[model samples]
Target: MSGGDGQPRDGSGADQPQPGRSEAEESRRGAAYGFTAYAVWGLFPLYFAALKPAGAWEILSHRILWTLLLCLVVLGLRRDLVWLRDLARRPRLAGGVTAAALLIGVNWVVYVAAVLNDHTTEAALGYFLNPIVTVALGVLVLRERLRPLQWVAVAIGALAGVYLSVAAGSVPVIALTLAFSFGGYGLVKKKVGVSLTAMQSLSAETLVLGPIAVVMLAVLTVRGDTTFTTDGAWHMTLLVLAGVATATPLLLFAAAARRVPLVTIGLLQFITPVLQLLCGVLLLHEHMSTARWTGFAIVWLALVVLTVDTLRHRTGLARARAAELADITP
Candidate 1:
């Protein structure tokens, strides 16, 4: 066995050397991938922000149409068209995919409303709380065991959400919409299985929505209320960019999600909300009351606990991976 410095190491004691470094490198690479994912997700506010005074439906239509077009182009580039073709052959799977597509469409429209209505901060909070919600849902729905600390973190986040809702004088519809929709989306994607490439799956999902999106765009154009004119060039450009922006990060996220552990991904999910919160306050100059700040602090604390637990979980997984690798070596 060799150390990072290349000195001969004691037999079976090699783990102290390469294993730590290997895991660290893996984590670093994984973080880079994960960061790329969050960064893309984080920057989404700016993308949606640019879609403009166009109502949520119009924005959604452009998103669906361009996203489908981009996904098709991407599938062709990757030569994964066969997977898509095969998907069309299975009626049940196609139906499920179609249902998932509608769910995502609803999620997208809700997100746009949040952005347009100056609820980006609430949207951030929603995603911020989503990881914990996902963890709790996993326990309830999938019969997964949660570490005690994880349970506490999830509880803390849930309480913070409730507090925030009351503080806001009503249910924070935008936050709830973002949270449940995304949480539900994640669950559905899991049911969809990893048999398909991320691109293929997203393409199929969007393809189901494509027809409706096309009809909406056409109707808007016919009524002269559409943002499809050459005078709307910048908006149109942003519209198409939405598809590229949407697909690229999702593809990056899929790459990272496969290479990293769920805990790692869960922990990394915090980045997007953090960025969005900053963008909301800094760029958009949105007001956050003291109660809102307090709620955010509570959520942040929960995330910290969740992150620590994930790190511990990842350490155990890393050790198991090293042991498995040693067993397989001649």
Candidate 2:
């Protein structure tokens, strides 16, 4: 039943484990998970657009409230409230999560506002710019080293801004806001470390924001300005679905992060903005100027360089590891 490689094989020897098959399978599954997350994120313009009766503020509040409820339910099912207790014992970690919560909360608000205001193209541009922002954050805040190509990639990303300004008529404030806010959130989460699981960290973040969200919702309800009570079933449904939309992609992203190596994850990150840009132009019927396209082209090339550089570095490391093992074997 087993071959020399320990793979289950038939008499024909046709089913033996191929070299690097496990790694390939893992990469495939990770890409699938990453695609699921980014795809959901790409389609967010439609989701936010559908919530027209509700303002961004109300929608964001409900998202926080419902996401908290969902996280609590997950915790109950998993029977893991230990992380919450641990957070209470550790103020520094709690503080980090709190900062991350605030940052992501602002990101949500800005993103929702952008979508509702017909700035989906700009929003997509923001996401397109995010990876380099993340890399820059890593270098500046985390003290991570970058290769020569990576540095060139960052510089190319920077030049895209000038191109956009010249060709796109003006600077994209919404795009920059989204890029920096999410970048800062990523930095904070990185600082928070792996002590808390994704679910637990998200729960902790929501815990920090939930009270404010509740108060805001309560105020809107009292003033009879909230769409939740006034809007019909369709609007209400979408509002509730907002939490699922937000949480599901995040959970998928976390799962993908665990399964995929960092380089693959970086490659997968581009899928989101590409989808968003398509949604913006094709689905949402937004316009794109030639200059804007040129700028986008530059950033796209930079991402290609960065990804290739990452893959090359990882391949080199893998070869080095294999050589080390071979040396030890003799």
Candidate 3:
């Protein structure tokens, strides 16, 4: 039943252990999870595009409000209100979630504005630069030492971003705002020790935004400026998809984060923005001037360097792990 490699030998001479089979199944699940996350992120431009007619501010308010409602429904269905109760018990954790909530709200608003104002490419650039920002944050906040090559990569990436900002006339305020807000969200998320589910975290974050959303919606309605009435059913559908569009990738990301190695997650994060860039160029037919293209090329090269450095680090860590295990055996 078993082979030298602990794989079970089938009647057709194929080796497959039950444990290996289980592992293979889990790997499949993890790939599906990761794929779903990246795919949703990749196609987000289409969803956001449909909501462009509604105006960014109104769409942003709806996103915040509807996401909150949807999350509440999810919590009710799962009967997981305990996370909210837990947060209530610890006001500090609630405060952190509230801060995170504000950060992501700003992120959503900026992203919507970028998409609406023909700056989809800029939004893509912001995301392309996010990994580097995260790495820079790790260096500053966590005091993790980066390899020499990584530092160089960060410098190059930053310089490319600055070049693009300068070339675009004004500083790329939208890009920097998007990156810093989302980066801060990531940092805050790292601090919370509470065992909140992904839905719970989203719920808490949106709950923090709910009152503001209500006020915004009421103000818009009273001013005879609600976009929903004139935006038609098709547009409304797109607005609602904001909830699904926002939540699905996050859910898949949560599952993938639990299953995959951190190195793999780090590698996969590039796919989203890469797809956004392609969508902006091909589908949206956005133009990048020669200098802007040059800046993009520089950023791409920096990312390649950073990625190689990361792989080297991961390999080194893996080797160190193997050596530690071997030492324990003898």
Candidate 4:
């Protein structure tokens, strides 16, 4: 039967559309996908560490080339080339995709270098700062208004950054670079919207950078510095599998972004840094000084404030939505 509001109702007259319930379910699913993506990303140190005997540059080239090849194969199999036609017609979006490709390229190279150089802890710190950077970008670039608690969180994060820089007697360049590059990439992705599927987006990004990767690999081969052939079959296999490793979490992340709010995505991102921190301290046996620990503690405090505010805000919105629904239902 149909209710007065034109919505379908069950025997008890409860509305069947259940917008609130469906939205909550989608949010929950997005959170799950985001968590899984970050968890995989957190374990990246181990994977990169295993790709040794290959320098950062060589590894990056292989990663780009292989990932591009993989994306193309998948797209071809799916017979999903129509998006390319659409993308070609939209110069603005194409430009955004190019910018995203460059930003991610920087992030990937820096990350690979950090792992190879035993800077995993610093890389973890970068991710820990990512949410703060993301929020700052929203304020500065998107011109979004922030609540008081958000302002407080941003202030605390800045303090933490300053303290870390002073204690180290230098700016945390790797951390800052990773945080900003990824933050910018995220912002561009958000602006681009989710009209494209995850696979399509990946394919577009890789295609943009595909030429550079190809040239780099060719140069490395001519110089006889390439490891794909010099390394044993096991090493070669690991390098090839890099395509799958790179694409999987990114695809999940894109899916999560499509389904969830940016705040929810930010909250879930803590998982990646926490896991990376553990990997650094326990697995890689990286040194963590008292000063570094203190800085991280301050960052944690900021994150706590941000997370609490987000939860409360979400709860308030949910309750208001429920009340509005109740008022409309007769």
Q: Which candidate comes out best when scored by TM-score?
A: 3
Candidate achieving higher TM-score, 3 or 4: 3
Report per-prediction Cα RMSD to one decimal. Answer: 8.9, 8.7, 8.7, 8.7
| Residue 24 displacement (Å), model 3 | 3.1
List candidate 4 stretches off by more than 4 Å.
1-33, 254-265
Ranking 2 against 4 by TM-score, winner: 2
Candidate 1 vs candidate 2: the lDDT winner is 2
Query: In candidate 2, what are the lDDT values of residues 245-306, reduced to their tens digit?
Result: 76677766665665567776667667667777787789888888787788889988888888
TM-score, each model?
Answer: 0.84, 0.89, 0.89, 0.88
lDDT of 3 by residue, 1-330 (tens): 000000000121111223544665765665676666776676667667877667777887787778778878877886768767777999879888888888888888787777777777777777777777877888899788988988988899889878887787778777677777777777776776545767777778878988988888899889877778787888877777677666666766666655567777767777777777777788888887898788878888888988898899889999999999999995
Better of 2 and 3 by TM-score: 3
Candidate 1: tens digits of C-alpha lDDT, residues 1-330: 000000000121111223445766766665676677687677677667777768778888877788888878766776767866678788777876876677678777877777778888988888777778778778888788999999999899988988988888888777776776667666665665555556676678788999999898888888887765654778778877767776666655655554566776666666788878887889978899999999989998998898888888889898999999999999
Once all C-alphas are superposed, what RMSD does model 4 give against the true structure? 8.7
How many clashing pairs does model 2 include? 0
Residue pairs with clashing backbones, model 1:
none
Q: Residue by residue across 190-288, what tens digits does model 4's lDDT show?
A: 887655666677678888888988898889889988898887999999999988887777666655665678777767777778888898899989999
Summed backbone clashes in each candidate are 0, 0, 1, 0
- The ten-residue window of minimal lDDT in model 1 covers 1-10
Alpha carbon RMSD to native, model 2: 8.7
